[model samples]
Target chain A: MKFIHTSDWHIGRQLHNQSLLEDQRHVLTQIVELAKSNEVDAVVIAGDIYDRSVPPANAVALLDEVVNQLVNELGIKVIMIAGNHDGHERLGFASRQMQQSGLYIIGPLTSHIEPIVLQGKQGGAAFYPLPYAEPATVRHLYDCAASTHEEAMIALLEAVTAHDSQGLPKVVIGHCFLDGGSESESERPLSIGGADKISPSLFKDFDYTALGHLHGPQYKGQEHTRYSGSILKYSFSEQKQKKSVTLVEFDADNKPQISLLPLTAMRDVRIVDGALDELLAAAENDANRDDYLMVRLSDKHAILDAMGKLRSVYPNVLHLERTGLMASNEQLGIRADHIKKGELEMFADFFSQVSGEPLTQAQQQMMVDTIDALHKSEDNQ
Target chain B: MKFIHTSDWHIGRQLHNQSLLEDQRHVLTQIVELAKSNEVDAVVIAGDIYDRSVPPANAVALLDEVVNQLVNELGIKVIMIAGNHDGHERLGFASRQMQQSGLYIIGPLTSHIEPIVLQGKQGGAAFYPLPYAEPATVRHLYDCAASTHEEAMIALLEAVTAHDSQGLPKVVIGHCFLDGGSESESERPLSIGGADKISPSLFKDFDYTALGHLHGPQYKGQEHTRYSGSILKYSFSEQKQKKSVTLVEFDADNKPQISLLPLTAMRDVRIVDGALDELLAAAENDANRDDYLMVRLSDKHAILDAMGKLRSVYPNVLHLERTGLMASNEQLGIRADHIKKGELEMFADFFSQVSGEPLTQAQQQMMVDTIDALHKSEDNQ
Candidate 1:
């Protein structure tokens, strides 16, 4: 059976406050075209279909159009699951009804994990979907003493193994932060204290493991277990990463062969570094000047209306940085001190910067009370 | 063929700032039970499944639960449409897939109207669902010059008739304001200046018309053309209404028989008019003290903390009005003059009353500019 593994579409995400709907639609169309040309048996979406729980109206429409083309127009089966960013119940609405048309949506963690089996000429593959759930939820659901992401994952894998009675190749689709996977700025923290990290050894028994929640396409330890990465470059930190969907094909012996198919975006997200005058002169001959760009100027002086000047030539320039100014000792000292502050102090500084005022004594006390309450709740869980 | 007709669920609505989700759930459970006991072939919901376009998460979950019970549990077909209150694209998500499970959700005004045919021993009934569309939408869809609700209905009905080629008993499910149907405070006006009113004669060709948007269960002008009313009383103005679902059955001759099944609410909304002291004394013997009550105090003298006192006895007392104070000639004069004021003047007064300050000259200018822009847009439409 040949299937495409994709995740983290983030359909309504914005780039530097600019709407990415148009760019998202362009790339999604390319995905649909690829699905049609590949003539794959099914498409497995790991998780994070939208950037937020309640997406905008146009985002909903875009998803509808894409799914309609995939299921109704192309006659392909689509298996999807909800991630941490999704409203589980909302995403799961009319799921049972949708199953009749070969669209499977797994939302809200349940006691039982059902495997969706797809048969092909070679054989059948049982695909188990483990949607994103908190460590507390995992503990309560399985009635276990698991307190960390690794323990919760171990508990969940045992449940999946209990249901793996069918003698077929198994594929596990999950959304979590796996150990050894590279991180990106756009990926949200799954848990406090960095406890949401699971090892890839738990999935050694499965033929293939498709993962999400990270923005780069990379395998944890083996090529069979990997992250297909996000559908787009969500942040500047991912500028050099090549985004692609993982295609898996199982042989007659149930051994899986993997291939990464690259996707071309409507406009690339790139970083341009040079002096102001030199960068402007380079932009004159730059063919991809319309790409989303972040400019880094190396000049030793301040420039007036630098952003406006760059935007005139490179229309989508989102950010401008002065490496020359940041080379000063005072700026370096501020950056150095940033790493030494506690979480509360860092939050207070962030609050002051955003609100243009210092946190009041009452507000600081309220934050302390909230942190205490959160700790108590975690302890109870 | 037998089917239960219901509409205007307005899920997640609140009464006087109090949540009505519990009451809504109680009534919806009753509707599902009636569907099960009656062994109906299908349930047709005309429109307004939600109170607003973007419903809360709980509201979406409630709808999901009800739909799952009916379609998955009872094996009954559900035909629903989007009204003005629904986000069309959001409500229609997965509709194509849902059709395989006998759940038809019609949203957005398309050029073509498809008939959902359900079979029975006597014959089959082709249900034509005309979801709520603005006058401009109707004109654009059918390429007609429809400027009013009556004209829009005429155009839509003509399109529906063109698709009635199966020679089956035709049933039309629509969401619109008819000419002779009574209106409640909860029913939003379909159009400005009463241009949204359509006559019952438009559906004379159909066998039965299950209408919605009017919260009262009554036939408009003919016995066959009727409204199923809402699942519950949404406003105090509907205090006297007997909320129910309309059951329609077709005989061997393809004729229709209609029956209204009454639904008992968890807590009735009622008005208690009398002196505050007498009302308080009477509450001692009232077994239904928890019922939502609106106290109309007829006391000649000023009462201290009348609302707080009433709430002690009737815990759900939502409103308190001093009828004696309102009987003054000065109050009557103010009320009489309200009708003579212009729209802009009334809006200004309302703004001042709510904000406790008069509109500034600049604000008045902005309002004038907005009104001008609105009028221009309407003219173009």
Candidate 2:
């Protein structure tokens, strides 16, 4: 059995208040194309299908179109689980009815965990979806004493595996912060107080485990346990990470072979640092001019209209910073003596530091008069 | 051909900050039971499936459950349209694919309007759904110069009728504020100004019209044109309005016979007016004690713990209004001359009006000192 593993679509995500819908749509289309060319039997989406609990209308429509294309057009089965960011009930709506059409969606944690069995040419494989759930919810639903994410997950896995009498190979799909997995800025903390991390040993009995919530594609201690990662660079910290989906195939004996398939984004994210003239010169010969960019200038003096000038050449410039100005601003911080002074005196000291001049005699007199008038108005009230 | 007509579900609606999900679920279950018992060929929901554009997760799940029972279990076709409150794109997502399972949901205005033709024991009927669309949207979609709701309806009807060549009976489903239709507070205004009101004469060509957007069920001059009203009394203004679903049966000749089927809400809404003692006495013999009630008291003096005392008898009391105290408070309105006085003097007069006393010398001195301290703090800033 061959399947494509992907997760964390975050369809309605925005970077620095800019909509990434078009970029998302472009990449999802590539994913669909990849599935068709590869002729995979089924697709598995681990979790976090949406960026927030309540996605915008456009995001809903995009998911609808993509799902329709996958299940109805390509005639392939899709198994999806709800992640921490999703409203489980909303994501699971109409899931039972959709199952007849090869679209399986698991939502909130239930007492009984059912594995969707898919038949292959050689034999069959069972895919168990353990959706994200709070430890309290799991404990109450299953009548257990699990107090943390790791304990809840272990209890859930044990319950499902105990009921499985079939000798078919088993694959577990989950959304959590595994113990040895690396982290990224875009991924939200699964739980406060660091109780969300789980060890890879819990899934040792399974043939493979496809994980989500970590934004980098890597394995834990076991090669069979992997994070498919996000389909896009969701944050600046993920600029260097290679985004990809995992393709898994089961042999005749149900042994797994894994490969990473790279995804090409609509625009690459780049960070550039140089002086103003040097940066402009570098931008002239850049191949991917439309890529989103963050530029840092090393010039000692202020450059007016720097962002405006850079945007003309690189239309997608997202951020611009001046190292020299930052260093100067650090020096302008008020001293201990200045903090003890009155508000007027502190203002005078800060203004002089920024302008490289002291307050004029006329300006000092105007400030004194303004403060006195303010005092008179306050006294009348 | 027989069909049940209903609309203005407002599934996620809340009354007095109280969640009405249980009430909504109870009524929807009754609706499903009615559909099954009647053995109706199809069920038509005119519009307003949700109270807000983005319904909460539970609302989505509720709708999904009801639709599944109606379409998949009962084996009846459901035709739905988007109302002003619904997010058109989100409501209409996956609608085309769902059509295969006998669920039809129409959304935004389009040039081509296709009718869902259902075959019955006697004959076939074509149900045309005209979902809610703003006048500007209709004008742009059809490339017509329609500045008013009436003009937009006429243009849309013309476009649909121009393409209808089959000699089948036509039933039009619409969600708009029809002229001469009464409304309640719960029903959102269909449009700003007075442009949303459209004449019933526009649907004269159709055999029958199932309308929505009004909380009252009534015919508009013609017997064939009707608003089925909401299944629940959504507001106090609709206290006297009988809530019901319209059951329409067409004979072999395509003639229509319509009857109103009254719906029994789990908890009815009522208003009672009397003195405190009278209200307490009347609450004793009330057969529907669990019903939602709003009380208006005629007590001449301020009553301490009035709400608490009333709730002891009527646990579901939603509102409490004091008519006698209101009359006294009206006489205490600030005088124009008092507005010219200082803030402290105005405050003294307001306090004296409510308490029927003047500030003591000690209190006045304390007020002055407090104001002086506040002024000193402002001066320091």
Candidate 3:
């Protein structure tokens, strides 16, 4: 059985307020072409189908068009799950009915999961998909006392294990932060700290595990478990990373072979660093001038309308900074980190700083609950 | 053949910033029960399934559940369309596949429409559903010269008339403001003025025209052509209106019979007029204290924390107005009207007030284009 493994499409993501829909559409078309050329029996998208709970209309249209081509035109099975960024209910719309058309979408954690089995000429594999779910939601659904992400995942995996009595080879699809997985600027943290990270050993009994959330494609400790990563460079920090999908094939003996299939972006995201004048000269001959760029000027003096000047040649320049002047200032880095931290984390840090005591686990849980309630109320409005 | 005709669900609508999901869910349940009890051959939901382009998660879940029950459980055919409030592409997701399950959803104004034919034991009707489309979109889609809603509707209805060569009775389902229809505060204006309203005579060829966008259930000089109104009282102005769905029965002679099937809201929206003291006294024995209320205080003097006090007794009181003090003031009415006008309308009014001349059609079109482009840019973010 051969399958294309990918995740974190983030269909409606934007970089520095610039829409990435065109970039996304370009990469997705390539993915569909790859699936057709490889003749993969199924495409497994682990999670994060969209950047936000409510995706824009054009994003929805793009997804519908791509999925229609893959499932209806190419006749390939699609297995997808909802990530933390997705509103599970909205993503799972008409999911049950769609299953008959070879598009399987799983959303919201429940007690019982019926494994989706894909059959190929060689053999078949049963897939157990676990979409991202909060520990509080896990407790409510399963009636389990899981106060942490690890505990919640364990409970979910236990259910999967019980349902693994089928004779076919088993593959687990999940969206989570593994214990040692690398973090990226674009990935939203599941929790305030390491409590959300789970050990990769939970999938030990499964033949393979396809993971998502991290933006770089890599494996944890084992080769059978891997993250195919995002389809595009979502942030400047991911500029150097090569985006790809994983092609997995199960042998007649149920052994797995994996390989990375590189994807070409419509316009690459790149960083250009030099003096303002030198960068402007370089842009004159740059073949990929339309690529999204982060220009770091090395000149010490302030350049008037630096961004406007750069954009004249490189129309897609998304960010500009004076690296030479700010490289020695550690405060800038601290402020960026502060901006990334959630309100709860910042409050926790303030409490520890002012009172010389960290909040207790119970106190942190209370705060999480209160903050979640507040957000829900605001969302209602 | 009998069918339940309804429209303007506004599933995620709010009343003065208060979430109406519970009320919507309750009313939708009643609608489903009504269909079941009537044993209608089909349920034709004209348009406006959602209140906004992007609905919240809970609203999506509710719509999913309701549609699932109607199509899968009850085995009834449900045909829906997108309204001005809906992002057509988003609303049309999985629509093609859903048609196999007897759920038909039409979105954007396309060049061609395949009429949905619902068959019953007694016979059937061919439904031509036209989802709301902006004049620009219509012009782009059909490559026509239509620059107004009336012209666009005429072009679309021409296509419907062309497809009506079939022997089945033609039923037109549309979402548009008809000429001479009473307006309501809740209905979002499709355009600046009467340019969005079309003549009712345009649907003269169809046996029955089930319309939407108006919040009052009424016929426009003809019983066969009618507005089903909204499912609930979306605004205080609709407090006196009785919301209902139109049930249309077609006989063997191709004639139509229309009846109104009323819906009951979980929490009624009401306005209470009296002094604060008297209102509180009356609330002691009020059976429906939790109903959404607008308190009009008649006290001549000031009442501190009036809203806070009324909320204690009438827990769902959403608004408190000092009608006693403002009774003699026409400025307040003028201010209310000013607030209701759109930016373009306000600008036009201001321009007219200062220059004593109305904006030329070309200039008005330019302002509309600029404003739309600005809004589109913001929405992309």
Q: Which candidate is the best by lDDT?
A: 3
lDDT of 3 by residue, A173-277 (tens): 999989898877888878765579888887777788999899999988688888999999998888889999999998877778999999999999988889989
Model 3 chain A lDDT-worst window of ten: A372-381
Model 2, A8-115: lDDT tens per residue? 999899877878999999999988998888888888999999887777777988998898898899987888899988878777866655676788888776788888
- Per-model lDDT: 0.85, 0.82, 0.86
Fnat values, one per model, are 0.68, 0.41, 0.49
Worst 10 residues of 1 chain B by lDDT: B372-381
Those runs of model 3 whose alpha carbons end farther than 4 Å from true positions after fitting are A272-286, A295-315, A320-381, B274-286, B297-313, B327-381
lDDT for predicted candidate 3 compared with the true structure = 0.86
What does TM-score give for chain A of every model?
0.88, 0.84, 0.93
Per-residue lDDT over A101-167 for candidate 1, one digit per residue giving the tens place of the 0 to 100 score: 9899998888778889887545678999999988788899999999898998898888778775478
CA lDDT, candidate 1, residue B24 = 93
Could you give the DockQ of candidate 3?
Answer: 0.43
Residue B175 displacement in candidate 2 (angstroms):
0.7
* Candidate 1 Cα errors over 4 Å, as ranges: A300-302, A325-345, A348-381, B300-304, B325-381
Clashing pairs in 3: none
For model 2, residues B1-381, the per-residue Cα lDDT tens digits are: 899999999998988877788999999998898888888889999999988777777799899899999988988888999987777877886665667778888866567888789876567789889999878888898898998999999988885577563777789999998888876767766543367899998888788999989889988968989899988888766778888899999987788989888888989888778899888888789888677777878898889999999888888888787867775655434442553355467667787998999988887677756754653343222
Pairs clashing in candidate 2?
none
